[model samples]
Target: MNLRRLKYFVKIVDLGSLTQASEILHIAQPALSQQLMILESEFRHQLLVRTKRGVTPTEAGNTLYRHAQIILRQLEQARSDMDKSSDTLAGKVSVGLAPGTAASALSLPLLKTVRARHPGILLYLNESFGTTLSELIINGRMDMAVLYGDHASRGLSFQLLLTEELFLVTPRGMPMPDGPVALATLQNVDLMLPRPYNYLRKYIDDALAIARVQPRVVAEIESAATLAAAIHEGIGATILPDSAARIIAASGDGVQRRIVAPMIEAPLSLCVSDHLPLSEPAVAVYQILLELIADLALGSQPPEAACAAGARPQCPEQLP
Candidate 1:
């Protein structure tokens, strides 16, 4: 079957009229009709029934339409891939990132690395909660993502990047809680928690449930900076990855962070769809991420250590 004929058929069904389809496809009406006729002849079935208002698909047409959608999508992806390969280290990359620390701690570094190594590559970043990021990656809306949680999708392959412990953050000068405060301690404490649907929230809730503690949440916030500000204002304490908590504590006035007792740790995972192959630029960025993460884990140093070690920092924090 001719792909062009299939394209014509799909356009006809979409517009519901040959005249409209021809106008949209920029083909002569007679040519469009001829293509549709050829498609119907190849299928040996009536694909559309004519009505006074417009054309409607027959049962056979509907079946073929579904397959045509898939075929067209694959064709488009192939074209995009081909175009991408024509230029080395130059293409568009869309990445989904988990909210909070993963976005700042992981995705930001990877983005900078990509920009430096492949100046021609355009980077698009989206921040989402864990499940949403997973769905985006699987659907091809995102080329890659940094996620925190269990790898639940069989269609995705994950690499274990690092394990980060959770920390309890509070305003500076606040009396430190007794050693290893129980999850119940959060009850009646002003608490800034992630939305219930967030993967980090799920991890926090699971840990609380395991400890048989119920936390009285004061508010649900999304951004790490917002949550840190809330903590600094003494609105409530929040539990977050130590990397983020420490960063926030270092910057925020009078804010302190402590590791959560009993050590609720989550594995920071880099996820990619098994169906997609990484581009050369993306592969280079991923390798840099591996090296950066290894450096962080080996010495628990901030990413700025790269700068200290003779590499210029791609992102520099403004000194307060």
Candidate 2:
């Protein structure tokens, strides 16, 4: 019933050992045990099951743990917000970005914007695969993450940033269609893409399956930069979002075409764990990224204008 006692109980569940939690909390073991017993008595339920291995939470304990995480996170956020200056905000924010998302689009712009605007805040960016980034966010290792789906996981809340169309990227000057390319046309094309489990790869595979088109996959890759470089080197072609293909094409070695006949658009989404409150600094970065995306959208020209010159999203080598 006591918040402080409940806080300690959550730590015990997290660390899986009361003794370890006691050491971290600087509370004597007997005192910690006494408070836990009192808490259990107040709740009138067996919150934890203890064995020689360690402690695990009961169903009721798990419920309390979830609520307690949100409570504590909110408490911390409130303290941070109060301590921040009216003119400037300062704190550490940890954000995870899926590999292709960061290298191709978000990372540099995010970093530059944060530096120019919230100079006092320290931003920690972790780049990993989508599933790994999702895990990091759900486990509280990262505050928020950018993902590529319209739907969110059980405990995550997602904001749709924009709908991004995927393009077929090839070596420069590769002959392609004059207009939108058919999805079935990729059947004979050699592909360099991320592994099957990757978000983009899975989407492409599913699309291909639906179209009854079996692509010739040459390599299973992880990094977007590598995927682009491989295609530019004539190793294979790849399917990429317009922004990513824009960055690659801007380098002057890649040519891209918009996929058609049931166009595939990977939704750019922002995901935050619903089980925890966002920190003040994380909130600032979130707003900034949203603003940047909005600015890019507003700056977009007409299709003819975009195509006459390559009008890639913000990167602008322009692939219509």
Candidate 3:
């Protein structure tokens, strides 16, 4: 069926009057009626039932109308997408990063890349706890996120990035306890963790629970800088991915120790809403962000080792 005809039919069904539809369409009532006749003849079915008040779609017509609406919508979307694809990628892309993800390393590099490669594209980077970011993405406020594993499945699609080791961060002067800290030892530590509502907190809480450790959370702070500062100021020790803790340790503010005894490696994922059809800019951002995460996993500066070596922030360029 012609898209033009489908549009006309849907409008007629919506207004419930051919005269009104003709007025809206700026077409003669007789011409509209003739088109309707041709459509009914082509289908060999009476599509609309006429009555004193107006016209209503028959069962077959209603079905066709529903399908027509979808078809018309798809065609409109196709046109919109084609218009976007015709030029250099240019649109606003919003990406969410949890406090524990190393957003600094990726944010600038991503902006730079978009500026250089797709000058029209603007990158909006949002930093929040995984729980908050997940909510934003699910509700369509944000487009995508980098999140910890346990938070992946609530109506969101996930692409596994890496399973990076977790670390116990202590004050700068605290003696590095030789090597990997056994996870069981965390039972006695006073932890300064993110709030209970944070996905990172949930992930740590569940793992510690399985280890049968009764965590002593001395404080809760959502900002990574503040969290690291707390540990540096000796407020309390806390757990974080080596990637997250690396910069803090390099700044000589905190010390990081790998967690062992059924190694605490939190799986990181690139997350997006399962229901939303990704736009061109969103897809570009996703691929670029994914590459950055992949670099973290396979790069020469292994997070656990990098922090110990006093390496600077692991930007994409610095990675092997």
Candidate 4:
């Protein structure tokens, strides 16, 4: 009935012995036994079966275990929500981002908005691959993240922000075909591909396979800056998000962009866990992100211009 009793019951089931559970729970065995008895009494069912080896969960106990896990999670989330509300928007928000393009294209804007709007909130940024970011979010190590590739978790929800086409960037003077180059064209060319372990690399490889083309990879680099530098030196052409390639093209006088024909595009996702209840600050941050995204979709108009047209200020000049 109580969270403590439920926790003790789950612990007993996990340890399979009252002595072991009590040792882990740091309670006397008699007290732990009493707690279990109270839980069974409240449920009006025999929760565990005693055997010479140890205690095993009865059918009723198994059912309660499942429900107890959810209940405990909910209770913890509620407490977290209360704590967050009491403190207002004054806690650290850690965000994980995929390396290279997504970090530049998505994380930068979101961070800028946060800095301007929530100056009191501390921001921690980490760059990793999409799969790593997802695991961190699931484990409660990150509050939210922007990731790429497939999102197949039922417990996780995503909002597709944009679809970015992949492009092959080369030096300005290099001879490029007039049309998009097929993957077969890359067979002999030095290619700077993402690491094979990366989700983006897998997606790109799958796309290449669909076209029945094999590329000759010269190097695999993780950092966007390193990849950009490699491309700058004309070491090899790298496949990158169009936005990223465009940024590099604009900055590097010698770099030229060629839109890869039979384009490979990947969805950029804003992912959050459905099982975790968001704090008021987190909810506010999410809403702000949606508003900022809407503004971006509306040509990224300046706040003054948006306000003049009776549209809500996407990045208001006020802070709480």
State the local distance difference test value for candidate 1: 0.68
lDDT of 1 by residue, 1-320 (tens): 78988888888988899989988889999988888888888899999999999999999998888678556655665655577655556666676667655334556566777777778777888887778878766655566776786565766777666666777777775666655665656656666778887778888888877766777788998876777676668777778776666666665554544444445777776777777666555565556666665655665445553211211112212110
- Which candidate order results from sorting by TM-score in descending order? 2, 1, 3, 4
Q: lDDT of model 4 at residue 95?
A: 69
TM-score per candidate:
0.66, 0.67, 0.65, 0.64
Candidate 2, residues 265-302, lDDT tens digits: the string is: 77666778876767768888877766655555555432
TM-score, structure 2 vs. true: 0.67
lDDT value for candidate 2?
Answer: 0.73
2 versus 3: better lDDT goes to = 2
- Collision pairs in model 1: 172-254, 190-236
Cα deviation of 229 in candidate 3 (Å)?
2.5
* Highest-lDDT candidate: 2
Tell me how far the alpha carbon of residue 79 in candidate 4 is from the true structure, in angstroms, after superposition: 5.5
lDDT of 3 by residue, 152-191 (tens): 5766877665666677888866655778887788777778
> Candidate 3 deviates by what RMSD?
11.3
Candidate 3 residue 16 Cα shift, in angstroms, is 38
Task: List candidate 2 stretches off by more than 4 Å.
Answer: 1-79, 85-88, 102-104, 173-179, 250-252, 300-320
